[model samples]
Target: MGASFEQRPQPWVTNISIDDIHSRDFLAISKIHGRWGGFETLEKWVCGAYAGYTAVCLRDSEGKLWVGESRHDNEQGAGATEVQYSNGDNAIFVLFLSLRGEDVIAVLPWDEWWEFELNKDDSNPHIALLPLHPDMRAKFNETAAWKYAQSMNGKPYGYHNMLFSWIGTINANYPPLLDAHVVASVMTVCNQMQPAYAANMWNEALNKRLGTEVPSYSICNCLAWDLPDLIVKTEMRGSSFAELLTIPEQDDWVYSDGRSASCVAFVLEIYKAARLFDPISRSIQVTEFTIKDAYSLRFFENNSSRLPKWCNDGDDVEFLFCQIRGRYRMELPGYNTMDPYPHMNEMCPSLPPKYSRPSNCLKAFPMM
Candidate 1:
C-alpha cells in the first residue's frame, strides 16, 4: 500500500536552488499516508506531526550532496546493517526503495534532476531544514559527522530497544485496542512459543532490572513461576512498573545481533558526534529520541528570513522546512519552547512532576 495523493496539495516551496541548502542540514520526512507497515503509521498517530523518517545531509570535500539514513526495508531484510547512502543518480531511487513508494520525493543539490524531474512533476514534493542557532551551525563538524556515520555504518537497526525507547509509561505509548496488559499478554505468548527470541526481545532487559541471570530457554518457565513474585517484590521495594520497564539505552551495549540504533537514534548520534547538541544536550541518550522528539529539539532553522527566498514564499503556512503533501497540516508542536527538558522526550525524569507516571503505573503488572 502506497500513500494516496488524489487531492495533491500545492508545493510548499518554489524555485528552490540547490545552492541554498548546506551540509549538516536535517530532513524530517512525514509519515507515509497509506503505507502497509502499520507500526510506522501507529507511531505517527501516537507521536503526532511528521513522525515518519529522518536523515542527515552531508557533503564531501568536493561539495557533492549525500544523504545518510538508517534504512530497514523489511523484517526479512538484513536490518539497517549499514548507513545507506543516496547520491545524485540514486537519491530518489533509494528514497522510493527504502520507503516502498509512499508518494514522496526527495530534494537534492542536482540542478538537472531538480529542474527536469521535480519541476516537471508538481505532485512530488520535498523539504529541507538547518540548524537555527548560528553558534551551533558554526560548530557543526562535517568531519566528525562523516566519521560517526562511518563508524556505525554496518550496525543493525535497534529493533530490540525500539518499543522500550518510546514506551516510557505503561499506557501512554499503546494505541487503541492495546495497553500494557495487552503487550504483556502478547509477550507472554511469544515467550512460550519462542523463548530465545522473546528473551532477546525483552526478557534480558527485564533480567537486567531484576538482577537475575535467567537463561533464555527457561524464560517461559520463569514467567510462569517467578515473574509474579518478582513483580510483587518490585512493588515492595518502592519501584513501579514504569521504572522497572524503562531501559536506559547504552551506546556500547551489544545485542544478540549487534549494536542497535533506530532511524532517529542514528541521526541524533551523528548530531552528537558533530557537536551539534554540545554544551547542553551532549549527555542525552540518542536512542530515547522518537522522530517527534528529535524534530522538536528547537535546533532546526525556524526563521523564514534566514532560510532561502523560495522557502519563505509560502503564504498559507510559515516554513519550518516544507510539507509538500499530506492530509493534515504539519506542525512542530513544542517548537522553540523546548525548555527545561531540551533534549529528552516527554517521559524523561528531568521533566516536572506532572510528567511523571500516573498512579496506575504503580499498580500495573505484566500479564502471566
Candidate 2:
C-alpha cells in the first residue's frame, strides 16, 4: 500500500552521520575554496532568494558532529556584511545526489540537532547542514507534512510564515502552522512598544482574544488568537497544516492568496514530516549561540542597537536584508547597515498610527 500524507510512521531510532553518507575520504567543503563557487552556483539556482542562506554539517572520524554556517567572505573580508544568500541547499542537494539507494532507511539522532553549538567558533557562528538519510527522506515523504509542503509547489511566495514555520517545526512541542492573520497578531505582540494596544484592538474588533506578552524570544512568527484550539484540532485530525494547505480557494492564509509556500518553510516542513527530530520533546538542548548559528533570521534583535523601540524584538537583520534587497537598490548593496531606520520601520504594521512612519507596510519580520 502507498503511504499517504497524514500517515505518521514509527520513529526510526537509529543514529547516523554525514561520514556514513559519504565515503571515508570525503572532506569538509571549507577546506576547499575551489569548490565554493560550484556550491554558490547551485544556491543561486535552487535558493530563489535575493539573499542566500548557508548551513553545512560534517561529522569527523570521532563521530562528533561539526556544523558550519555561511559567513560573509566577500571582497571586504568577514563580518563586513551579512550573508545575503546561503549555500546550505547546495550541500544538501549534493549529498542527496551522492548517496546511492544503499543509503536508505537510516535516521539521525534527534537530540544532536537540537544540541548543536551555535557559536562553534568564537569569531564566527556556523551551523552545519546535515542531510537526511534516504530512508528518512522516504519516511518523511509518506507524511502529511511532506504532502502539504509538496502541495505548494509553484505558488506565489511570501516571507511571513517561512521563519516562524522553521522555528516551530524544529523547536516547538507541536507544529506552528498558523493562519496569516494569526501570524500578524503574534507579530504585533512582539513588534509593538505598547504591546497591549494591538492585542486590545484585535480583541475589540475581531471579538477574539490573543496573548499579550511575547512568550519567548525563540518564537518568531504570528500566533493565532486561538492557536491552542487549532493545535488541538490538528491533534484530533492527525495533521496540523494539511487542512490549511487544502484550502482550494486561495484564501488569505496562503501567500498572495495563491495557495503557495515559501522555500524555507517548504524545506523545514520536509524535515518535520520526516521526523528528523522529536516533535513532542521540544527540549531545545542547544545553546543560545547554537540556535542563532542555525538560523538566518535574527533572534537577538531585541538586543540590537540598530532597531527602533517599536520594532519587534525578534526581528532579524536577514529578514530586513531580504526586504531591502527585494526593493530600493543600494550603491554598495553588500554593505550592512548598523542603523536600520527607515527600512526597519517600513515593514512593520503592528505599531499604531502614531508609531507608523509615512510608508505604511503592514508586514514585519518574525519575532524570533
Candidate 3:
C-alpha cells in the first residue's frame, strides 16, 4: 500500500574497509517508513502524512547520537518525550525538552543525563533544559556553552511551519520550520551518501539475509546494525552472536502480529555488508545461511538487549503491553514523581535481592 524500491547488488559492500575506524565517509541512513499517514493530500494539506515516518540518527562531535524525527509532536502531548525518556526505563537522556514537547529531535547522550535548562531563544525555540545529576549542575558553569545556555531565558521561541512545496516570507512563529529544515537537510545529505538503490532492494536484501518471515518488523532491527556501525564502523553492535538494539521503536519490539525476533537477521545483515568470505563455502555468503547443528541456533540469546530503560513516570509500556497482549501486567520500579526528572526517579525495591540492585533501586528498610 506504499511506494516500493528496487533491489540491486550493493557493490559498495566490497569497498568498505572493516579496519578503517576513523573514516568519515561511511554514513548510515535508517529510513523508518511506517503508517503515520499523509503523503498525498490536496488543498492546503499539512505535511502530517501518515504515508510514513522517517528518522535519521547521526553522531555529533561529542560522540552523542542525535535522533531527529521528520515530524514534530503536539505542543501539549507528552507522548514523544514519554517514549523518548520512557521514564528512565530506556537508557536515553532527552537533550531537547519543551512545554509543548517540540523535541522532534532528541540527543542520546553518552554520559549520564543530569538536570539543567538553557531556556529558549530566537534561534532555537524549544527549551534545551533537562534533568542532570544535582552534583553536576554546579560544575556545569565551567563550560562556555553552559554559561551561554543559562543566559537564554528571555528570547522568544520562534517557530515556522515549513514545507518544501511552499515558499515563504512568513513570520517565524513556527519553530518547527527551523528544526524540520535542519533535520531534513541532514537526512537528505546522509541519504545522498548511500549508493543509489531502491528502498525495496535494501529491504529485500535485509529479509533474505535474515531469513525473516516478516520483513516489516525486521527492517526496524537494522537500526541495531546501522546506528552502531555509523558510530564505529569497524565494530558491530553486540557481536556476531549478539547485538544491541539502541532504538526502541514500538513496532519492532512491542507491537507485533506473531513475528519472530530479528537478531539472526542482524548477524547476516552485517556479515554481508562487511563482505566477509565464508571459509567453508569459500564464497561470500549474503543470501544463504546454514548451521551444522540445531544447538547453535539460540535465537533468544542476546536478543533481549535493549538501548536502556527510559520510560516516563506515567507512561507505562508494561501496562499497555498487558492490555494489548492480554498478559499479566508487571509493575516496574516505583515512579518518584518528586524527582526533577524521570531518569532520576527511584525504582521500587524488589521483595528479595536476586541480582544486583535494579537501576536507581530504592533502599527499603526492615520493618521498624
Candidate 4:
C-alpha cells in the first residue's frame, strides 16, 4: 500500500528506525482526533490545516513502547514536545504514510483529545485541541476506562453517525488496547466542536436558570468555547467557502444551480492583543486590515499558511503568501481609494466594498 503513492515502497525503503506497535504497555497518542488512511473529505481539515500524522507508535527490543507525533514540536508538556532518540537501543521513529488499498482503521481517543492544549493566536491554534497518550496509564480500567473500538470499514463516506459512533467507541475503550485508547482519542478529535458546544449552551442556560455561576456540569468535559465556535462560521462540508458565499436560491441561486464554487480569501490584518474573551488585551497587535464593503464577503486567504514542519528551524513563512483565485487581489489602502483598488501583485487582492473596514486595517495587514 505504501508503494502506490510514491510509485514504490521506500522500505527497501529507508530503515531509518523501527518501532514495535504491539509490545508497548502505553502508547502516547498525539492526536486523539485526526484523519487516518487519507480519506478525501478529511484532506482539508488536517493535511492543509497543518495537521500531519498525529502519533507514531513503536515498540523496542527492550519491550518498551515509545510514541511521538508531528502535531506540535516544542514547548508542550515538560515543555518538551518532540520525540528525539535518547538511546538507540530503545528507539524507533514511525512515519504514518498513505498507502493504496490500506483500509486503515483510524481510532480516535476523544477523551484525551479534550486534554489537548488550548491555544489561540498563531494562525493554527487548533493544534491545542489534539491529544497525546502518556507513558503511564495514569489510572487503569476500574470504571475509569475500557478498550472499545468503532469501524466505518463498510459505511458510506458521509454516514456522519459513523463518526459519532466512533467517538463513543473510543470513550468506551479502555487501557487493554492502549492503542485503542489512542484510537479512541483520535476519534474524539474527529468529533466536530458541535455536540460539545450545543451541550454547553443548554447546560449553561440551565446553570443561569439556577441563578449562579457555580455548580456547572458539562456532559462533555472536553468542550472548550474559548477555542471559537468556528463551525458556526459556515457549513461543515463541501467546497470550502461555497456555503459562506451562497445564499438560498431567493438570494443568489448560484449554489443551487450546482456549479462547484471555491473560496477566494482576502487576508487583511487586524491588530489587537491576544486575550481569552476578546483576543485583544495585553499585546499590541500590528497586523490589521480593512475590507471594502462590496462582494458580500469576508476574507480567509484563499490559501492556508504553509507552516514550517520544524517550528524553530523556520522554513515556511506564514503571512500573505496566501491562497487566492478568481478576481481576488491584494492592495494597500489609500484615502478615498477606488471601489476596487488595482491589485499590486498576483497574490494581492483588489479591495471589495461589501465589508466596511473594521478599523486598523493597515496594522492588521502585512505590507506587500
lDDT against the true structure, per candidate, is: 0.54, 0.26, 0.22, 0.21
TM-score, candidate 4, is 0.19
Q: For residues 66-117, could you state the per-residue lDDT of candidate 3 as single tens digits?
A: 3322233334444323212222233342233343543232222212111111
Q: Find the 10 residues in a row with the least total lDDT in model 4.
A: 265-274
**Residue 31 of model 1, lDDT score:** 43
Predicted candidate 2 versus true structure: per-residue lDDT over 1-368, tens digit per residue: 11121211222111223333311111111111234344433332221212233332333223544322222122222211111111334322111111222111111222332232221212211112223333434444233332333344223332233232222111121222434445445645554555454333222212111112233343668554433444355446554332332111111232223332333333333333434434421321111111112232221122233323322222222222111111122111212222212212212221211221233222222211
**Candidate 4 local lDDT, 1-368, one digit each (tens):** 01111121111112111221221121111122324324322322211112212222233234444332222222222311122222334434222222223222222222222234322212221121111112112221211111100111111121211111111111221223333335324434544456554333222222222222232354554533221232222223331211111111110111111111111000011001001112222222111111111111111112232312221122122332211110112121232222222211112112112212222222121111
Q: How does each model score on TM-score?
A: 0.67, 0.23, 0.19, 0.19
Give residue 79's error in model 2 in angstroms: 40
Question: Could you tell me the TM-score of candidate 2?
Answer: 0.23
- Which 10 consecutive positions of candidate 3 have the poorest summed lDDT? 286-295
Model 2 misses residue 50 by how many Å? Answer: 16
List candidate 4 segments past 4 Å from native: 1-5, 8-13, 18-35, 38-51, 56-65, 68-368
Better of 3 and 4 by lDDT: 3
- Candidate 1 per-residue C-alpha lDDT over 63-102 given as tens digits, one digit per residue, 9 for 90 to 100: 7675656653333332222223444444311222232321
Which sequence of candidate numbers ranks them by lDDT, best first? 1, 2, 3, 4
By lDDT, who's the top model here?
1
